[model samples]
Target: MTLGALMLVEYLRKDMVAHGKIGLTMALYSTWNRGSSYPRDKVIGLLGIIEPRNSFKPEYSWTVEKVYRVAMRAAIAEDGNLNCLGLISEKKQSRNKNLASWVPDFELHSEPFRDYITSLSKVLNKWSIYKAFMIPGGSPDITTDEDDSVLILKGFCLDSVSVVGTQAPGPDFESVGETDPELWRSSTRDALNQWRSLLPPNDIYLTGETQAMAFWRTVLVDLNQGRLASKKGGRPKRLDKSDLQDLLQLETTDGMEGLLSTWESCLRPIYRQLRLIEQFNRRFFRTESGYMGLGPPDIQPGDAICLLLGGSVAYALRKSAHETWTYVGECYVHGIMDGEAAVKAVEDKSDFTEYRLV
Candidate 1:
């Protein structure tokens, strides 16, 4: 194996020995021009060791002992490839018009039918285990009778549970303005005025284009210095430029207001890009046919969505009021009930959710 691959194995082995900690979690990996070289960043991330190699500068090869350290930790009892758990990659070449390849270790298995069945069974058992503990989906009888396992095996039915969630706000078009003359005056006066007010006094002599550049330059400088940003807990934080692009490149709001407001004080720099708005649909909003469009695609009935709530908040603003809505249930289904039908069905019939496949 190449140094990169060896490093990956080392890190994965470490994660295995740690019972699923300290390993790269990426489902897909791409090497330059489809190479065998280890990804430098991934190795560092997995091993917590900085493999100092500059893309612009060549470096020495890794030592055998370094690679062995990873291998050693992964050995369950000194003779195995890994001790606690082994991660396998199941990559395959693809001919689809959209994607060229599929990655993710779980997908790499040859017996796809069996693999998916096993995967689904494990997931159901996991929920069943938790349900036995009186958790949200837990039932009292999941661990009860021998016959319960047989009933649950008939086919899992997901239950529909409604949790209160805050509705996301609509697009802030009044702040940004409309696209057409009938709706918008098409005047640059207000935006220009606001831009002028934010300018440093010395920029007065600058032409409009130059002044705009200067204003953005100042914001960029602040961004570089970590000034025009927000921080939470102990880590450094910055606005996600991708989320902003998705908002601009696509016309619809994807409930990303919290992510958008990090650099809200510096909004003009982002809004000035006409191409971003034009490209939003294609980049941010993907159609059902997989075609790109403007703005974030709306959540439709039967669409699979995850529900994630924030752990804490400092504001009552709708966006900050609760955690982001995770896309959990299948998007094509209208209600959570449809997505969880299998679990509910199993519970209804069996009075239990968890069971060992054995």
Candidate 2:
């Protein structure tokens, strides 16, 4: 069995010992890789392990798409949070076009990297780091149509994408054994330079941090300073003054290329963290209001950055029809991640608009 499978087994064992019943959402996420010859088995096979309180039953006649859709809706309703939405793949990575944009494709294992910083598999653990909806007393307000095809949510649009940069190199580019190490470094440096240029000329973001600081933080999803902030009981914090000084040094140096050549010890950790993010398929984008972010690889120029009621992170959404939106994947917008946008909307008395996701 793979390491992930083993970890899942261990987690289930621990859960049985502590809680006596596995959580429906945690069970689904952990067993996502347990595929079978029949696609329906993906959801049905999980029945033996999950809690008896769950309403899922073997529906052999249902199509694979329907099974996944039902499973996703049930998981969200039971969890009372939008964490399951984080598992939805980017548009290009998804295999089932028929499945609703909000539903996760169980067959496609797009995320291979499981480092502490980027992996979303452990739902409870990652929530501490990506708290986009930090406001207290918030809960998911989810409903579905008669056929359960449309997912209705309540949230406000945060911003619209205006500029999108090139996608960072894939995992192949960073494989030292298969490709030249120098080529990998050179390509990454070039990508970083392009992303840096895409930032607006403004020195400071609305969050009051320097452009350089925000750029670095966003690329690493604000987890670069070390794993302490993301520990079990810890909360994500801003990059300190010392971190800013290192970034400023890189800024003054003759571009990223020059700084890479120097190979300074202080800068190595930051670059290492950045490389971790680049290995994942994602793109850097700036919103119309100048907010910077890193999102799914398929994110586009006009996609909407929205903060769903109970989501722990911001999401990228595409308007597919006059009255509905398509879920583009989760994203990391710099300025409004920690509930700043929600606070402002509340102060302004902005109404929570209904988003119908197809």
Candidate 3:
């Protein structure tokens, strides 16, 4: 273990190449899962999954507080050019007067929260979720007091894709309670199977080990936080067959293929319901939007799949504009992140769109 200040030791950087980001993060997550008292942010930081600022001192100096300060600046901008790099989630964002889903304070917005995220997005030109998980290495162009809200780095309008998928930081399962254990299990299986069908052929369908590992880490998080309930020591959150319908971009809901539709039904819900739909499951018959990938729950209907210029991974942005196109929270866009499909979309010029992020 190392101090967060010097997130990456020389040997550790080499080890990261061997383990990869998701593997290393999961290893850290596993430690936290084993009852270690570490916040999620701290864990990710020690993995060097944080953006650096100013001098890259040999000594470990980026304390949790300093990191948080950097994070705060990204989250609530006081001015433009809030230089940052990383990804966030739907649950952690509240830049606008967005309503909270499960808990009010958690997913809701405050002045600090709003300003910080706006600046972060403008600086990084990406938004969607979480306490900014900054990628280490880049230095900030501005310096300010620790407590001061940082200025923006040339803000970009995040015109929400007319379509948005599930709201972030999703609802905690334990709080929501399962309808019935048996039904929940069977239904979840059906949902997974439903999602499976949409994947590429069995021979071709496989997520990178990093992403698959990340999915498990997400499961671990959901399990620990009571978002995925268990029966005895824990209560798993449950949903119904009909509730899972939102997973697909059905014509009825105005689903927008890989991205979300500007339609109301898809964006209106706050993820209180697990509303993904099974393909050819009666729901799609009603809509015009053709079946998309083996739609994943996290990337739900009405979200845009964007292959950012510099990013190796594809992001799911909530389309917020038509003219000067904008989006929020570049998140995990399950099927498209792999690049092959995104390239195909661009090639076909059918499902593809070329939009400027900032």
Best by TM-score: 2
lDDT for model 3 comes to 0.29
Error of 1 at 30 (Å): 11
Better of 1 and 3 by TM-score: 3
Off by over 4 Å in 1: 1-332, 337-343, 351-358
At residue 61, candidate 1 shows an lDDT of: 55
How do these models rank on lDDT, best leading?
2, 3, 1
Residue-wise C-alpha lDDT for candidate 1, range 1-358, written one tens digit per residue: 4433443365346545654433222211211113223433222223333222221121225432222223222221222111011121121232112211111122122221111111100111111101111224321221112321111111121222222111212222234432333212112222223323533344331223344343332222112222312222112222245532433221223322322333232223223211111111111111232211111123222222221111000000111112222211111111121223334434666443222211
Tens digits of per-residue lDDT, candidate 3, 186-212, equal 443444334333323323223342332
RMSD of every prediction: 20.1, 4.8, 15.0
Superposed model 3: Cα runs more than 4 Å off? 1-87, 90-184, 190-291, 294-301, 321-338, 341-358
Off by over 4 Å in 2: 1-10, 13-19, 90-94, 110-126, 134-138, 173-183, 225-242, 252-279
Please tell me which model should have the higher TM-score, number 2 or number 3: 2
Q: Write the per-residue lDDT of candidate 2 for residues 1-358, one digit (tens) a residue.
A: 6444555566566667766778666676665534477777767777887756544664888888888888888877766777777666434643687889888777664233322123332253324455666446556678888777898988899999999988765434222223344755677677778998998777888688888888877875765333344343334345666656666555664645554443222123223322223225578999988899988888999999998887778888899877999888888888776788888888999999899999
Model 1 — TM-score against the truth?
0.20
Most lDDT-accurate candidate? 2
lDDT of each: 0.23, 0.68, 0.29
**Reference-based lDDT, residue 157, model 3:** 18
